[model samples]
Target chain A: MSVRVVVRTFSELCITVGAVIVLFVVYVLFWTGVKADTAMDDQIAQLEEQWAKGSASAGPGDPGSARGPGAAAPKAVAYEDGRPFAVMYIPRLGFTWNKPVLEGTRTKTLKKGLGHYASTARLGEPGNFAVAGHRRTYGDPFKDFPRLRPGDPVVLTDGTSWFTYRIDTRPYRTLPDDTAVVDPVPEKSGYTREGRYLTLTTCDPEWGHSHRLIVWAHLDETQPVEAGKPKALRR
Target chain B: MYGFIWRHLPGNTWIKALISLVLVLATVYVLFQYVFPWAEPLLPFNDVTVDNQ
Candidate 1:
């Protein structure tokens, strides 16, 4: 090729490569969110169907009456990886700001919704029940996580009962290597004794995961599905 | 590069546009299906994790 033609070809190649890179960024930021939203909607629909059937068979017995304060605590059901076991609702985020809580904290699980740390306490139990979610992309379920404030209510339901947790502290920035944020007592929360705690974890700074944003809450109340939604959830 | 492709292709402007579209899509497909997957683990995206300590 002549010198002029060679220069023209190099410019064309550079433009094509630049366009490809732009397309890739669009795919990662936009297409992934679309796919995640579809997957989460399907998962939520399936869980709702299962809960409807469960309640139908359980009859009119009040769920709260079965597990009152003095009653023996029900056995915690084992959850399979990537399987959703509960739905989390943060009224402060928005009335529609709810996501399915899956069993494990793997990438695949977080794409569907929130992922519960396997080592943490189970929902509505004594220790710290911790969950992790993506702050950006993959539906960005915790996109508004920074908006949470002390006294904000984070509610979760396992189809039969509703667990309402009150945020006691603001978002605390921590390094990715700090696992003590989810400890049974969570010394980071200044607790020395065991108590019912809920921990929400997500990537800090919106688009990056260099650090983690931790929010600690205490279980404030528990009610049955038959008793209607909790007062915190009331509009 | 595009000039050479245009001269070598045996079609009108419409057909050339279609061919160019196909080539771009094929490039993307190869990058995502093979190249990107190979490079993913090398990136720091998945390095975000809390230590057991």
Candidate 2:
């Protein structure tokens, strides 16, 4: 090929590659969020449908029992992998901000919504109930995690009961290998004994995962579904 | 490069535009379906867990 043709062809190839790179960025940042939002909505809708049908197998006890003296103990629901068992609502984030809590912490599970650590204690249980969510992409369920403060409520519902947790500690940074943050009695949160706790974890620095940002909360109260709504959820 | 592609094609402007659109779409489809999936494991996008290593 002639010199002019060669230069022109080389420039054209560079432009094509640049366009592809931009497209890939768009796919990762924009397209993934759109797809994840739809997936999360569908997952929430499915969970609501199951709850409406009263088909959710929430442990062994009768789910109709109300919270009071002599009421039956709330059994920990047996959660299946990739299935959503609860809906988490963070009023501090937004009035309408909610996400489905899936069972496992795999990439596919987190993409749908927040992923509950399988080994951690269940919601409202007398242990550390931990959850993980994406910080930057895939709908970014915890994108505003740093905005949470002490006394903020992290409420969750399992179709039959509402569990509200009050944030006691702000965002604490730790390494990705530090699994103790999700322990039944978390070591770094200043709690000496076991109690009903909730831990929210996400990637740090908005877009990087070199470390984790953790927020520790204590379960404050529980209300039955027959109760219209919790005080914390009231606008 | 787009100019070169236009010159090499034997169609009018409308036909050239259609052909260019198709080529871009085909390239994007291949990248998303094959290239991105193959490259996802190597990327650090999904390693945000605090699990015990």
Candidate 3:
């Protein structure tokens, strides 16, 4: 081949090789990210189990316990499917994922557990107990979150404590700011009610977050820890 | 003509393919098993406090 032709061919080959390497890197990054997420789920589950037991045994009055005044209650244990960790369930969405919510609804927690809004409502209260999670990433734990119809059950079990709530009105329109969903009252009206409410938040689209989707539920009942099966086995 | 020390570099497609496959497998195994576990502690958010610790 002529030198010019040879150089052109070499340049094309270099570009092709570079493209392949780029594609491989992207694939590996995505795969590793997913693997990391799966590992996180397992870790959260394990942490939930440990936290549940530790909280249960320590009791509210215990010196070294993490339970707050509201955290001391014992109910039927609940665990997620992939790991031996406790999860709060929303029977309406059939939402089952890991628990002991994290701060700011970080991507990692949303990956493992429902990210409870740190500033707002308590676990079992008469106000909104808002939780934010990813709609697609981290196994899409909240993939069905927005589909939760009114009257569907939302359950949260801390291995010894199980709290059930039913889907209520999901009146508010979609928004981007997550904090707005858990505002003291409806963002548009600023209206607050006395009844216990559960708010499930996820990305609007099935696999992405062009908008925010929410499912609202009302408290049905709180069951005792001794009334249900051991959460460890369930996990 | 001088004798070249590193003689023929065999071009074996099968060997190249096998090596690529082995690399991919090793990557998967390490990512899923050892590397993932090792990287768990590096997760900053994993360690948190909900209440008075």
Residue A165 shift from truth in candidate 2, angstroms: 0.6
Using DockQ, give the best candidate's number. Answer: 2
Q: At residue A124, what lDDT does model 1 achieve?
A: 87
Span of ten consecutive residues with least summed lDDT in model 3 chain A: A76-85
- CA lDDT of A157 in candidate 3? 60
* Winner by TM-score between candidate 3 and candidate 1: 1
Better of 1 and 2 by lDDT: 2
Measure candidate 3: CA RMSD: 8.9
lDDT per residue (tens digit) for residues A1-235 in model 1: 5899888888988998898778667656786688789988888888899889876886665443556421223534687788988899998888888889989887767778888998888888888899988777778788888889999999998887889999988898998989989999888887778889999988777766678888999988887777899998899
Candidate 2 lDDT, A1-235, residue by residue in tens = 7899889889988987898888788877887789789999999999999887664454435545567511324444589999999999999888999999999898878878999999998778778899998887788778888999999999998877788899999899999999999999899998898888999988887877688999999988888876867889998
Q: Report lDDT per candidate.
A: 0.80, 0.83, 0.54
TM-score of each: 0.87, 0.88, 0.60
**How would you encode candidate 3's per-residue C-alpha lDDT over A117-174 as one tens digit per residue?**
6666766655777776655534455656545666666677645456777666653447
Sorted by lDDT, highest first, which candidate order results? 2, 1, 3
Instruction: Rank candidates, TM-score, best first.
Output: 2, 1, 3
Instruction: Give the chain A TM-score for each candidate.
Output: 0.92, 0.91, 0.66
The docking quality of candidate 2, as DockQ, is 0.49
Off by over 4 Å in 1: A57-64, A69-75, B25-53
Q: List the residue pairs that clash in candidate 1.
A: A9-B1
